[model samples]
Target chain A: MKLDSAGLEILSGGECLNLLASAPIGRIVFTDRALPAVQPVNFCLLDGNIVIRTAPGSKLAAAARNAVVAFEADDFDATFRTGWSVTAVGHARAVSEPEEIARLSALPLTPWVPGTHDHFIVMAPEQISGRRLSR
Target chain B: MKLDSAGLEILSGGECLNLLASAPIGRIVFTDRALPAVQPVNFCLLDGNIVIRTAPGSKLAAAARNAVVAFEADDFDATFRTGWSVTAVGHARAVSEPEEIARLSALPLTPWVPGTHDHFIVMAPEQISGRRLSR
Candidate 1:
């Protein structure tokens, strides 16, 4: 789909979600040290939840104890002059149950950056919304 | 500065911070119901804190009662072929004190979206970090 400058002005909700589903990575955003923070992670949309893996003492591990967090994924096609984004808001918690962890870990979520993928943080969405710039 | 594909690959820590300082809007990330959530907000890099305005029943109001959250902002320059981003992670709390609220509300944070902008949520960064993809 080729998009002109004008076509990139407004995006529909379905297109936004479709874009999000296709992207395998996104930025996990949260507050740390009284400031805004973001980190890149490999993610998967499983049964309507966002899941990622991290090591102990990592920010993801620490955030699992928090009450809420937000996650976002986006893609921009310069050639096509189009882009889409999706944002999810919900509670983040660590998945410690052996069965659940194993099941989630079995998914295809290989981190682009190499590190210990020990901890798993799941962001369960209470509300999912998005926007797009498309022709 | 003109950023080519290669020049946009590497971004210094200071550059990232400066980009963050210049931008007035960011995405607030949190967990709503075991799911990832994000909302756009007008923010300020005030005294090292990220602040935004919202209504009483808004997501920001509810997140203030939580222990932690994340915030992120980014800018992409297709012309210059460069982009920069910054992320903050820390605890989020509501500014209840009248004086503090008044002081924060005084900042130039006009909502791009129309609605009741009453409640104020502050993301106090325990850790601030960023990266840039430059050419």
Candidate 2:
């Protein structure tokens, strides 16, 4: 196991992607009012890309258009102090073309809330990294 | 039950703080290489301020110094599709003074990993908000 400077195990690119795919929920980081902001969303991994559905006019949609963003997902056992976190940095593009929107709509992605989630944001990660902390 | 435009219930400020205090882990969003980055950390709520400990030379410690960042914590039940999320945005200042650091050392805050977490970052949120999704 490769360990980082802090002694936590460093995850390979494949392991990072696999861990990201295994989780249904993740946090998206974007700039809001020129400062960093985070929002939790249900996401899916498609062809090594991250996809999230949101309202077209939602705050995230506004900030994520062609924007550099970070997506993170993890699971931990607080009692055992063990967990792994995966972070993917990429450019978020809003799907506006009818054909692309139709394609994404066919995916299993669904919003966690009850409302219209017609917009699709697809991110192809330029950097994927993860770390695992063991008890 | 106040609902936002997206149909998610908007939680009150007090409720947001309460929920934040209940969570042991949260994702902290900060700028890195001129892009957004997120990492999950175990944190504590003290006097309505968010405090997290990290390595003195860690990436998080460097990026969080006097910078505007966001902290988010949430809990969800995928089976029932019920969840709540709280987001706090403010300036993150690294605590360096000896007396202050000495006082913080007495807190219950502890690092999730097995390493030295001597640097402290505290954020007294200027803006706090939260939302809930019901099944």
- State which candidate has the highest lDDT: 2
Per-residue CA lDDT of model 1 for A34-133, tens digit only, reads 4445666668878777888877677557755655666777765444434566776678888889999889879887644344676788887775666555
Poorest 10 consecutive residues by lDDT, candidate 2 chain A: A107-116
- Candidate 2, residue B73: how far the Cα is off, in Å: 0.5
Candidate 1 segments exceeding 4 Å error: A1-13, A18-37, A40-85, A88-128, A131-135, B1-16, B77-81
TM-score of chain B of each: 0.82, 0.98
| Model 1 interface DockQ | 0.14
- List, in the given order, the native-contact fraction of each candidate: 0.25, 0.84
* Tens-digit lDDT string for candidate 2 (A1-135): 999988889999999998998898999999877978888889988899999999989999999999999999999888998999999999999988999889899999877777789999999999999999886
Report the number of the highest-DockQ candidate: 2
State the TM-score for model 1: 0.56
Please give, as one word, the docking class of candidate 2.
high
Query: What TM-score does the predicted chain A of each candidate obtain versus native chain A?
Result: 0.82, 0.97
